[model samples]
Target: MASTDAPPLDANRYRQDFPILSSVLHGDQPLVYLDNAATTQRPRCVIEKIVEVYERQYANVHRGIHWLSDQSTDLFEEAREKTRRFINAPLREEVIFTTGATGAINLVARSWGDANLQAGDEILVTEMEHHSNLVPWHQLAERSGCRVKFIPITDEGRLDLEQLPALLTEKTKLVAFTAVSNVLGTINPVVEIVEQAHQAGALALVDAAQSAPHGRNDVQAWNADFVAFSGHKMLAPSGVGILYGRASLLDAMPPFLGGGSMIHRVTMDGFEPAELPAKFEAGTPPIVSAIGLGAAIDYLEDIGVDNIHHYAQMLTQQAHDVLEEVGGVRFFGPPPAEKAGIVSFTLEGIHAHDVAQILDQYGVAIRAGHHCAMPLHKRLGVAASNRASFYFYNTPEEIDALADGLRAAKRVFRR
Candidate 1:
């Protein structure tokens, strides 16, 4: 259900802000870009913000007494504050800037996992997790001799939550899972899972790469130990992401990377790590990209994330209806009402790559693969599928265009 508060989303009006949405592909065809689950197109505002930083205020953040450095440092920290507010994180110090969600998860797996986890400890992730969420845990397990267990997904592409009770025991040190499946579009109940993890004495980490751009993620309400999301997936530039850790937990964990800006003092004996955020940040952070993320957050808040969520769901429902009429289509995951704006499907007698090629000729761009969830593909008994993921800027017309493109692909393959 849509949140009751926000005003209705005017997708058409907002589309103008995203300059790339008006591009002409294949020389003549209007571009219908729907690969949002991978990464979203940035608005003009975010783009300009990046340029502004580089042009006027480009300097390495922290420890510089000069004006340029001070300007850059302020912008960088201000971005962190913006991220904290956006996710409703309890403190600005809790927010750390990293390369992307992968970096964030690895930070946790290395720092916290090394300090807290030991041999025989368990980490529970779901079968539907993107590789970024799964691989780190596997690596951590390999390093710490901790066991990695998966929460199985139903045939309907949802986590079989009933098994959680059995899986989450005292031995489980962490429960790391995706907020939404990149391929399946299944929106896992973050709050419910986090609560269960807590009850079992395991800290919960949310991979919000798929969910953050579409809706509000109140970290406080979820009460998760850590939350990670990429700026690129939410209409900002790449090379920047947020990691929100609980204040108490962050205070206890060791630094993941040690270098310049991360140490308070250096000596012949040893070095003391800097405070929260900086301790994990290490080296020069993505100064411009982080500022761009702040601008993107501003743009989202102005339009209201709730409105974006409702609009994307509506577009997703429309996609499901239109694709059904295209014939020879098999959809994955739950119905659109129960999921995000991602629809993964396969066509009869046509390979996913072939379908994707035909769609591209029509200037319709969609992802066609396991979408970094190879294990999920193995579970679903398919090699890969064509995915059309929507965002707030997507329209009903675009969904219809996707259907028409699919029909074209079918006719071509039949020939």
Candidate 2:
């Protein structure tokens, strides 16, 4: 059954903006790229933005007074401003650039956690966190003699919200969780969670690696202490990530890395760090990637994030319905209404990798494995699963192709 209420979306025109979408796959099959959870295909604007930077205005930022350096610096800072407005941050300096989401999370766990957490403090994370969000805290706990605790998840892959209040206590130093689960596709209640954390006098950190690409990310509205996301996952290039920290909190925390541009003054004995953002962003930053990210933001804004989110939800619903009728598919997450645009499942008697390979033969790109959420996978009692994540450019016709490809995989496996 197709959704009658799905908002009208012009996917054909949007697909034209991504050049790789028209390319043929595996002999003659059309490419049905569904591996968006890993990374989204870059639009022509974003690609050209990177190329234009390298071809014309490439230079080191903030150090030299030359024209190329000044141009690069302005573009780089403009990217920060773009991101700040994109997420609705109160201060532009709060948006710090890093290598990726992993780097952003590690920055908080190392700098903020080290400065705030003590021997008896607790760091609360949820079971559905990606390793990038979980491991850094675990490392912090090991070093600080603090404890790392996880909020449980329901069988349907929803966060067990009822248990959260009891878990949060006066000893809790921070509540770190994902805005959207990478594997489960569950959109967690960020505002509610942050409120709870504040009541318990703890800071809240949101890993928006999945959520930032799908919908609005307002740090002010959520009252989040920190928010982290990667540009590549949102149609920008890799090697660039964002860490949105509260100005006061960022100012209090020590520098994570030490080098050029992040220092205000240096003596033979020690050094003074730069202001918010640059204090955390040591060394030369990802100049071209930042410019590309700005262009990606511009592209998304032109289409509107709300429209993309709604269309993607409709596509997710279509895929969920088709897969549910396939007879042997076992789903890992909540129903489509409860999820965003990701669907993770397994075909009976067929390994996830095998399922993925068969689908690839049909030119349908999908992901197979734990998706860097091994703890969540372990809790779900599945060793691995196949995932098909959708973006706004995806269509109902593509969902049909995915269903047909899955049926072909079933036939090949004799299941």
lDDT, model 2: 0.92
List, residue by residue over 1-415, the lDDT tens digit for candidate 1.
2234443677788899999999999799999999999999999999999999999999989978999999999998888889999999988999999999999999999999989888999999999999999999999988999999999999999999999999988899999999999999999999999999999999999999999998889999999999999999999899999899998999899888989988999999999998877898888888899999999999999999988888888888888888888989999999898788899999988989999999999999999988999999999999989999999888778899999999999899883
* Residue 72 lDDT (model 1): 95
lDDT string, candidate 2, 142-183, tens digits: 999999999999998999999998999989999999999888
Model 2 reaches what TM-score against the true structure? 0.98
Model 2 clashing residue pairs (backbone): none
Superposition TM-score, candidate 1 onto the true structure: 0.97
Q: Show model 2 residue runs off by greater than 4 Å.
A: none
